[model samples]
Target: MLDSLKVTVLAEDSVPYESPLLGQHGVSFWLEATAANERRRILVDVGQNPDALLYNIGKLNIPLAQTDAVVLTHCHYDHTQGLAQILRAIGKRDVPVIAHPSLFRPNFITAPFFRHVGVMQGDEPADVHAAGGCLFPVVGPMQLMPGLTTTGEVPRVSDFEEVGIALSTIDANGRVVPDTMPDDIAIEARVKGCGTVIVTGCSHAGIVNILKHSVRPGERVAGIIGGLHLVEASEERIAKTVAAMSEFSPSLVAAGHCTGFRAQAAIYAAFGDRFATMGSGTVFSFTA
Candidate 1:
């Protein structure tokens, strides 16, 4: 079991403090887990800009070289563009990079405007290998540490939750298809005395669906952090999401990045004191 979990926001769309930390249209989190005298450091999502990630880490006094593993929540540029730089910063060639095989496929958003939002073009896998990092492509749920696991491909059972029209990808036949974002995964940890804490990236798989797929039977969710991807959601959709989240009654909900102000307000109204604002340089510590 995890004795405690510390999550530090290394890069985000906003900055809560007036420090020299850099902010961008992305998200990155530094996770530290301790269990039975063993400590594990993990990086979830690298953000879009390497400068921001590096600067924030330096300002936060985080040791970049100590990361045990790097996990990508999806293939979106905002969540993965800085992977190579991060690997270089760690200065290790054998670090493990856990992600889905489908992450490299061409993906983009086309609703409001057409733009290529996939991982940076040209030889990302090769770059990772050149950086001396080994890639672990997963298709199903897998455990990374003693009490930490990835949700893998979340099953979409929520009727109100559906992949938006804005996102799509190219098929093998060069046909454009709706990108279901199967690679969108979340980190789930069983905190010894505090139940479970779920950490997400963009939550493109749907936060409700992710929760249903991640939370085990008889387990309570103590907290949830990261983007909900409700920036462009309708009022009805936001309301439904808030209602579903209430079922888990998470003690803490720190929403940021793709979670827009409108959705954040609704979540705040619903979760009340349980909701905490998140941004670059934000630090969350949970103990058993």
Candidate 2:
């Protein structure tokens, strides 16, 4: 297990009042995990706008070049668009860029007039490879270290939770099927004395599903950070989600970027002091 863990929001949809950091409609986090004498740094996402993300990184004094790896939760543009540029900024050869095997597949929306919403042009697999980033497209939990792992493709066991958006993809048979977003995942870390800390990107697999899949036997969740992607969720579904989250009784739930104001208020109402607003430049540190 990690002796300590620190989460720093590199870029998000908002910033604290009067804060100098930039904000965008995206998500990115810098994680520092320590075990004994060893320490590992990870960059979760790059957000959609590289300029804003890089600006926040610089403003927060993050050591971008020293990042050990990156974990992309899904193929959404807001989360994967700037990956290539960020990898180049890391300047590390062969840095592991982990995500689901289907991350590069065509994901889009048709109701809004056929718009592609998956990884953008500049951040394709080839671009990542050319930037010295080694891609690890996986389908199961990826063990990043002794105490950290990716949830991989979470199971959609929560009946009340759904993708919420009308995203679709083309199959080999040329059928346009619903994009269930099997690539969605979360970062699961066992921090000593802190139980489990789960960091998510958009929770496209559903927050409850991700939570249920991340929590292990006899372990309590200390914190749940990142986007929930509940912007357009039905009120009933949001209420059910809040209820399920309350049952888990996590110590902290800091959500932002697509979590929607209504859901945030619901979460705060149930969690009270345990809920927090995650934004650009926000930092949460925990010690063993």
Candidate 3:
């Protein structure tokens, strides 16, 4: 059986009216799907502010008990900070927490001006004490459920994809150093009769590469959802990314987060109505 999927943004730059929810500078996606005769719910990336995450989830009236698992794409604070709150909300249930082993490494990348913003240091894994959940380390592509899988460590395929982004982690000497994004991964869902939907939380590992790695050898592309992380791209980089994306023939793109408004404009110009904006309070459903 095919799954019924709905992606709701529990936190984003904008909030829905009547919800009185405030927007935070982070990204989190709440996804639910029914597959293999069972209803499955997964929270991909827990967002930064717990209050905002909880408020939006409550405002959306999502049943916390229904959540089956929590997948942290990476150890970035914006993506994993509110995990504790989510586990608390779920109560008593011990779900699996899938992530890269590096996710628990301390002193990951520091934001451009992290000192001024007073964000927590990325040294420890987010606390999940609701029922003492387990951390499932993943490397390379791994099956999450029946039709859902994680395209682990996307390859850098284009110059524009890594333009000017110098990611780093603290070394053994505790000095900030340069590093590549080995922990980056994207979630892929094989939709029945609709092909696949490759969802990412900031395509640090190239959006083009994520789509290419999601398939076996020659599978058709369906949709590309989530952040493309093209905020500070140069015109040349943007042009190249747009040009390459066209070849994949994705049906729809629900992109946001670090994608930036300017980048989205360029994408809209190239892809037209196929471009989608993802944020808090947004919902995407897939039915079989």
Candidate 4:
């Protein structure tokens, strides 16, 4: 287990009250995980706007050059648009970039005109490699440190939740099929003496399911952070999600980005002060 975890919101859809940092329609977090004397700086997702992200990084005094790794939670544009440029900014060769193998596959919506929603041009796997970043398409949970691990592919066990939007993709047989977003994943940090803290991105697999997949047999939930993707969900689903989330009793709920206001209000009502609005420049600290 790690000694402590510091999560700094590098970019988000909003800024804190009167904050000078720029906000965008995405999420990015700088994770500083400490295990004894060893510390690892991991970047989770890169918001669409590289300028805003870099500006906020400078304002927040984050050193991207020394970053240890980058983790992509999914293939959404908002989460991955600026990855290549960000990698170049790091000026490092072979920086590990972790994600699912289907990350570069075709993913999009049918209505509102045909448009691709997955990884766009420039930040493709080849682009990442050209930018001196090495891509690791993992099929199973991988450990970043002694206690920090990726959830791999989250199991869709929650019957009440679904992906906030309808997406489709083409299979190897050239048949159009429903995109279940098997790439949706999260980071779980098992802190010593404490419990598990989950950091997610656009939880298309459902937050409750991610939580259930994250927590061990007898472990408690220390905190929950990142977007829950309830922007397009029904009120019934939102209520059910909030009710189900309360069952886990997470110590903190800092949801933002495409989480939407309805779900945020319900989460606030359920979590009270434990529910915080994570925005650009916001920082959360946890100890063992």
RMSD of each: 1.3, 0.8, 2.9, 0.9
Assess each prediction's global lDDT (C-alpha) against the native: 0.89, 0.91, 0.72, 0.93
Candidate 3 local lDDT, residue 236? 79
- Tell me the deviation in Å of residue 113 in model 1: 4.2
Residues 88-139, model 3: lDDT tens digits: 6777456777877666654333576433111244314445633445678788
Kindly give the stretch of ten consecutive residues in candidate 4 with the minimal lDDT sum: 214-223
Would you give me the overall lDDT of model 2? 0.91
Runs of candidate 4 with Cα error greater than 4 angstroms are: none
Candidate 1 residue-wise lDDT, 1-288, digit = tens: 799999999999988867678899999999999998899999999999988889899999998899999999999898999688789889987999999889888888786788988889542899988886799999897797878888888999999987543788888899999889888999999898898999999988889998898887788898899999998888999999999999988989999898889999999999899898888999988898
Clashes of each: 1, 0, 1, 0
lDDT of 4 at 24: 97
Q: Give the C-alpha miss distance for residue 25 in model 4, angstroms.
A: 0.2
* Best-to-worst lDDT order: 4, 2, 1, 3
For model 4, name the residue pairs that clash.
none
Candidate 2 or 3, higher TM-score? 2
Model 3 off-target regions past 4 Å? 16-20, 107-123, 129-131, 172-175, 216-218
In candidate 2, how many Å is residue 271 off?
Answer: 0.5
